[model samples]
Target: MIGATGFIGLNVVDALQARGVSVRATWRKKSITVFAQKRNPEWCLAELDDTVALEEAMRGCDVVFFAGGHYPRYSLDRRASIERGRADVRAVCTAAMHADVPRVVYTSSIGTLDGSVAGPVNADDRTVDPPRESVYRATKWAMEEEVDFALARGLDVVTVLPGACLGPWDVRLGTTGVLVALLNGALPWWVDGIVNVADVRDVAAVHVAAAEVAPRGARYAFGGVTTTMRALFEDLARRWGVRFPPEELDVAAAYIRADVEEAAAAPRRGRVPMPRELVDLVAWGRRVDSSRAALELGVVARDRETTLEDARQWLERMGHVPRRAEATAVRSRNSAESTRGASAHAGSRKR
Candidate 1:
């Protein structure tokens, strides 16, 4: 499994290990010892561009999980991101083909599919004609194109397009960063939008299942639930008992705020306070369907409420939430629940 140290990739490794499958996981220069200590999978130190090393990693392996790709944050290096995205897929597919690997499971993003349509997005959905202007989206689209090219060259490949993934092992806090930012008080208001969300654990399970049972040249779009931004924050507020900001910003206001934040933070931090990509993402309000995955690959999603609770618990346990804040939140939640229970009992007696 390439990108074994990544958020999704590490979970994939864990899922494979849980099934008692021997996995040969890869790492770059900076090693992730947690992957070694916990899973004990054979580790390969290989860069994405190193075709020779990738070939070595693929040797003797019947299946390869190519979960490595560039998803830049804060900074927009369009040229470099596109180049690396294309190169990673090319190198992995080429190495897998040369190694005569029977199955290659590539992790793509839902961003490659069109989200502007009025209904739930599926694997067959295509991006808008001429494509939208976003470096990250373009990079993912390019990677998908690379997959198609590899398929034409007689390589058997399956693609898994996961939605905004949350849950544990988000060491980098990539997709879950919004929650962190809200908890940390960095974000003062919510953007009015909707997003398809999936737990990383579920996503990883789908990837492993796809590798095992999915038909070659198949593509699966999987996410747990579709929720509005307000609904998500409201859920968190209910669970945490915190008075989160109630203001909702329109897309225009959000873009303007992002621009202002970027201008102010760039000089000091060399990173934008909020990337334009994020603004565009929050402005995206599309539902996604993963029923095909469920019916075909047996991919099942945990309930959304349960998934959020797990995420909150993980964040608290990982020290991402301060002790004092957590205590306050707990007390507030208990008080609110107690009051609601009392009201319901009283109403029942009156009735």
Candidate 2:
């Protein structure tokens, strides 16, 4: 688990450990890993920007989970973002090749896919080399291209395209920040657009399944539920007893606001009021068909309501969310979730 301290990476670590899979998790020297201290996986120190260190960490591992790809925090500098993302992924792929690793399960975003305005999109909807939209889209596209280069060099790699993932352990409040922002009354206006979502646990399960059974070069989009931004915001506000924003911004206005906020947040390296990626994701998001994962991996998502509740409750417990929501937030953890036997976990995989 390369990004053992991240939102999705931490969930993936827990899921794999629950199945008795040995993970050689890596963390960057500068990353705060207090959360990882509770988890008992073997820790390795490796930096994504350092190819030599990453290669050393990859030594003797059967598979590498390239989960810690170079995803920029803000989308202000397009050319720099694209170059950094490309270079980082190129290093990851090259490290895997140099270490003679057999397989690599890479984590990528659905932004790299060709989103459809007509209907649900799937794996076949490939993004153009230079994405026609925001820096986030272009960076993800460039990173995936490096994986294609590795595949041509005889690397066995399976890429996963996960939609807006939401569940527990969102320490940085990445995707779940939208939920937190809404609950805390930080969101000034809502943007009306498509939002495809999935449980982080389900997404983690598919990563394990892809390594175990998916064909080489296979890509799966893991969003099982689709809803519009307005409907989603309204539902959360109604359920959590919070007031929804009165104003709704058009896509154009949303982008302009996000850019302005991102520019301000760049200097402090702090969280933005409205993330540029969040804007790009919803503006470019498409309802996706994840039937391939269900048919091939036998992974069915739990109810969307249950998934959201788990995330809400966890945030409250961690105090990232205000204590006022606790009355309706906390819930039982023994809810319906997809399961897989540990019979297939072979040699260790380093994330």
Candidate 3:
């Protein structure tokens, strides 16, 4: 398991162990892998640049999980980000070929896909050009292109595209940061756009299945529940006893703001409520067609409310946010529903 220290990587690790499979997880030099080390008994120090070390680590392994790739903190440097992203995937794919691993499951983003989202989109949606406006999209497109080259050279590899992921063990916050910021009263307002997400557990399940039996050069897109950010934030506010932020920022304005916010947050890696990637995703994100994964990989879509509730409880358990009363939240949500109904009735009577 490569990228065992990351959010998706950790959950994939848990899934691998659950299947009674022995795992040899890799870690970068700077990461504190103690927590991962505790759960994953075997660990190897392998950096992305160290092809020799990666080959040695993959030696005698049945499958390799490539979840560790270049994730840009800001969408500022297009050239650097694209080059680095391609290089990382190239290194991993080349190493897998050298080590003669049977298959590699690479974690990619659903953001790289493009098509008419009037209904749903699949692998047929990929475009010849990256959305030039967002560097995040470009970098992922470049990475996937590298995987295509590797496949042509006879390296066994499958790709899994995951949208926004929310769950526990996201110590670095990742996509879950947007949720944490809202619940902790950091994000005062939000932009109205589509958000496609799934529990990290479900996404990891797809990874395991893909590695075990997926056809070489196959790609599975995993997206569970879709919602508008406004609706999600309203539900969270009502449940958590916080006032709803009614202001919906304009999408174009939001893009500029996030760029500035990321520039400022770069020094501290501080948790800013909005990031460029989040803006880019929601603005351009489309509903995914997961029929292929569902039919072939046993992917199941969980409801949005259930997924969010689990994520919130986990965040509280980890002390990332203060624990709130479930019963109280339920009661408050019920009361709000009653109030809205009554107001609607009153308006009808007046009309």
How close to the true structure is residue 227 of candidate 3, measured as C-alpha lDDT?
77
How would the candidate models be sorted by TM-score, starting from the highest?
2, 3, 1
Candidates' TM-scores?
0.86, 0.90, 0.90
Worst 10 residues of 1 by lDDT: 269-278
Candidate 2: tens digits of C-alpha lDDT, residues 176-203:
8888888777888768888888899998
lDDT per residue (tens digit) for residues 9-55 in model 3: 88988988898988898888887686687684488889999999999
Q: Which stretches of candidate 2 lie over 4 Å from their true place?
A: 324-351
Give stretches of model 3 more than 4 Å off: 115-118, 325-351
* Model 1 residue 233 CA deviation in Å: 0.6
Clash count for candidate 1 is 0
- Mark the 10 consecutive residues where model 3 has the least summed lDDT: 115-124
Report lDDT (Cα) of residue 259, candidate 3: 85
